[model samples]
Target chain A: MTAKLAERPAGADLVRSGIRAQAANSSFAFVVRAAAVSVFVILVLIVVTMTREAWPAFWHSGLGFVTGTDWSPSADLYGALPFVYGTMVSSLMALVLALPVSIGIALFINEYAPRRLRAPGVYLVDLLAAIPSVVYGLWGVLVLGPFLLPYVQKVADTIGTWPVFSAVFGGPVGLKSMFLAALILTIMIVPIITSITREVFDTVPADQKAAAVALGATRWEMVRGAVFPHSRNGMVAAVLLGLGRAMGETIAVALVIGSTAQITTRIFAPADSMAAVIANTFGESSGVNRAALIGLGVVLFAMTIVVNMAGQFVARRSGRKGAGT
Target chain B: MTVPAALHVPPTEAPPTALATEGLGVYYGDWLAVDDITLQVPRHHITAFIGPSGCGKSTLLRCFNRMNDLIAGARVVGRVTYGDVDLYDDRIDPVQVRRRIGMVFQRPNPFPKSVYDNVAYGLRVHAMTEDLDDRVEDALRRAALWDDVKGALKKSALALSGGQQQRLCIARTIAVEPDIVLMDEPCSALDPIATGRIEDLMQELRRDYTILIVTHNMQQAARASDYAAFLTTEVDGDGDRRRGKLVEFAATNELFTHPQDPRTENYITGRFG
Candidate 1:
């Protein structure tokens, strides 16, 4: 036995080198950590660049940069209140208009569609997302404006009679107005909210659904009890994402918003958003004017971030509540 | 549907049969999962379906409550009767059938909700909201889970241990006061100690509800059940296809000691499945 063992060739060790193996594992971990940290670094870099470029406007105007409404580049007067009002009203209008319609479409696709029609229905809804914003802008200018002008005029004429309605809906109602811009934005954001909410509803566990039906819940009741409760946080997140998209939209709003620096309560009146103003004026402006445009970009970025953070906070708290004690 | 009228009020107390299947066969598309299963489940008694895996015992149990209807391609042939009402009749709403006949699944599927909410779910769904807290407490008491979870009623049901969750599911089912309860392998996911607790709970529940349990554990069938239905799979000529069929159903003692069918005898003797 000893002679045979000696004649046999020595086998390689089965165990790997501990240091080498650990080094390989930690090398992959370090790559992941680097990728994770880069997001924060990139955000900080953008903020620094914006703040540095915007310093001249901040020093010249101080708080007037936000509260002032004048915008004459020749005189170096720059106020962002009109643009801020425009962004807030248009985005809020889009959200209010799109949320119910999106939810209805999502529920119809997931629950009420025939088995054979479900896939194609979902595909059609998702196809809405593929339509370029430029195309929507072109449609808003060429087709939507002509189509909705009479209705806008009629509403402005009729509601303009009442004291309260006149206060809110007064002024010239035109083809290119805040209402048209918001309507276009609503069209663009609906598919986004719809698809995300539909996917969230689909993720509701089959067992919980069964539990609800087993308790004698009607079809609608099952949706209320099991499907809605399970996906409430996800639906909120989807709406916030849609709001973000609407707030940052530039080309579409600029095309139809009749870019003007006047804050008016009348949604039918022409107004300017931060993005629309920047996109329209960034080419011709120079010196403090260019710095002021960058400052508006900073404000828009901050607003979007604050809204997104609030959305995430709400989603997280509701998630914890759903998880129970 | 109006309140109280919408409820399934038994015309008479202690009906001889809670659920009876006549020539019942369940099929998933073309594949017959369970065939020609005709059985009468005695009211307020524990009837256990015992067999090896893939024997369609759970399939047959689902048929009683029309839970099989939830499966996309699944279809049931023949009639399942509850009292004078034919459960499979076209006019009968499955939602009402399910409310009258509740079910407990193999796994503990407590909703991501508080323990109190879990028990109150059926009550609220059925519009039985008048004495909700009292009803929830009574259900927890009946399921033998009240003592352990009383202090944590507001706690998430998911925070409970496996056995406690199963008992919570039972409480949820019984809170609606269904006339019959179907349990599909209720104790299979639990440890021996938890299994023992559930078996004891079953004994207490039998006094108020008709219990039909599908169990793979023959010992459990022998120990806890008043009646035993033995089932086994029979392979077709190609040997690639198998279907479940009932072999013998008798009193638990008789079925265990002197099984009529040779296959059942072999199974009981641990000779073959």
Candidate 2:
């Protein structure tokens, strides 16, 4: 009927206007699809690049790259043990220190914080995340380093007899160590964890809270029994995402870490991580040294992919199960 | 409908007992939702608070347990006395008040736990018992859900049907052993079968607890509540939306048979909201 009417002279304008409206909607849909594709492509490209570099360490070095501990690039002896230990220890430190603070901050924003304060609290947390990696490094060097030194030195001197402390607390506070890197990483990742956790916590339905409240559960009880349990998987994912951030950080770790290739966790002792090693050595070294560091980069790159893939795999599987249920 | 010729005298004059509101008012920021409602939710019976949408029936229920305080701007005024204690007293805690006066919301929001866990949630919240298993079993039995859900006590509460879920919520509330249970449109989203089950459950449970239910269904109000408070709101003489008067409160049989107020008649007859 529309085709028959459009054939007539009188129907030409209406058909043209209808076509224009349809075209507008069609264009809007096309833009949305294009944006989605771009995001997908960017993610795929990052994965491909990381894997392309990573495949060498996995293919050539194989189990040795993962299992071996010594890392000496000076005379062509390269083992990933210390960097792996440093990465694990630092990330673990970051997570343990940041987890409670991040969760607390998220809860405050989601529940206890006043209505007027909620949005601003969120903004402040985001601003923490927005600060550049170099600024964090500079801030640690100029401010946090001196502040942490005295207490760290005292603790190291006090606990030097303990096995763990004996290994880590040998140096004074100014020297780079796993603890300092971990502390810096903790401060860096708190905002990221809090922001993501807060978002996920916010998505928990109001009705659920109200229901728990009606059941005579206190605010803390409601969070513990309902909100936390419901959003636990997402919260874990948020923490893992923060761990990923802590592992990959370069300038901040480089600035405070004393840049020694050792697995020592002493807060006062100097030590280095994979990212810190690569950052400090990249510009100065050449030939096999750079390739070894590149090889370490290959290792670091591989480790993060596995970590993030594990994180996102858990996130997606849980998301699918949650959505299905 | 007029006050019956035989039952001509007022009803609330029995005594100043049960629930009494003295010059009560409520505010949220600059907005006043409840305008000085002085009422006595009768003891040993169900009281229905029936009003149009946003007439503050639900708001009034929240006030009893200080649930309104959860809202950032909400404030309570005047006095609400339960037995001898003033609920709004400066030293009083909302948690204590809420524990005594449990509430069930419109939607059935069971905690995403096993049926047993959902029932035991309140007991654990109140820290009333260390042995939660027996307590959970007893509460479910009281809510008339023990038989149906008994076999699969380990099943998630979400697996229950909408009606069963609501009853599970009731079981959850009752587990804490509150004196008064306030239900905010508890059956609005339920099917007739579910609604009937809840209505019957209320009748069986009312011997030990006072219940206040806010309902949209007039028939439900007539069926469930022994005493009814018909609330209404209108653009008042001050040109602001003033909460309508309490109109009247009476025995269920008398209120429905011969309602004294024209507004009640119109509302009951479906002539207008």
In terms of TM-score, how similar is model 2 to the real structure? 0.89
Which 10-residue window of candidate 1 chain A scores lowest in summed lDDT? A316-325
Going through the candidates in order, state the TM-score of chain A alone for each one: 0.88, 0.81
| Candidate 1 residue lDDT tens string, B95-189 | 99989999998998888788999889789888899999999999999999999999999999989999999999999999999989999999989
Candidate 1 lDDT by residue in tens digits, A1-325: 9998788777745556699888999999999999999999999999999989998998899999999989777888888899999998999899999999999999999887777888998898889889988899899989999899888788878888688998777757777999999999999999989998898889888888888887777878888877887888888888888898899999999999989888888888888899999999999988899999999999999999987887777666655646633
TM-score values for chain B across all models: 0.93, 0.91
Model 1 CA deviation exceeding 4 Å by range: A1-42, A72-75, A154-172, A309-325, B1-15, B237-239
Tell me the tens digit of each residue's lDDT in model 2 across A1-325.
9998878798466554577888999999999999999998997786677556556545655677657766666545567788777777888889999999999999998899878899899999989989999998888877888887787777767776567657656555564567777888999999988987888788777877887887767899989878886777778788778888898999899898778776655656667788888888889977555656767776677678787887787666546525211
Please provide TM-scores, in order, for all candidate models, with all chains considered together. Answer: 0.88, 0.89
Q: Which residue window of length 10 is worst by lDDT in model 2 chain B?
A: B1-10
DockQ each candidate and list the results: 0.54, 0.50
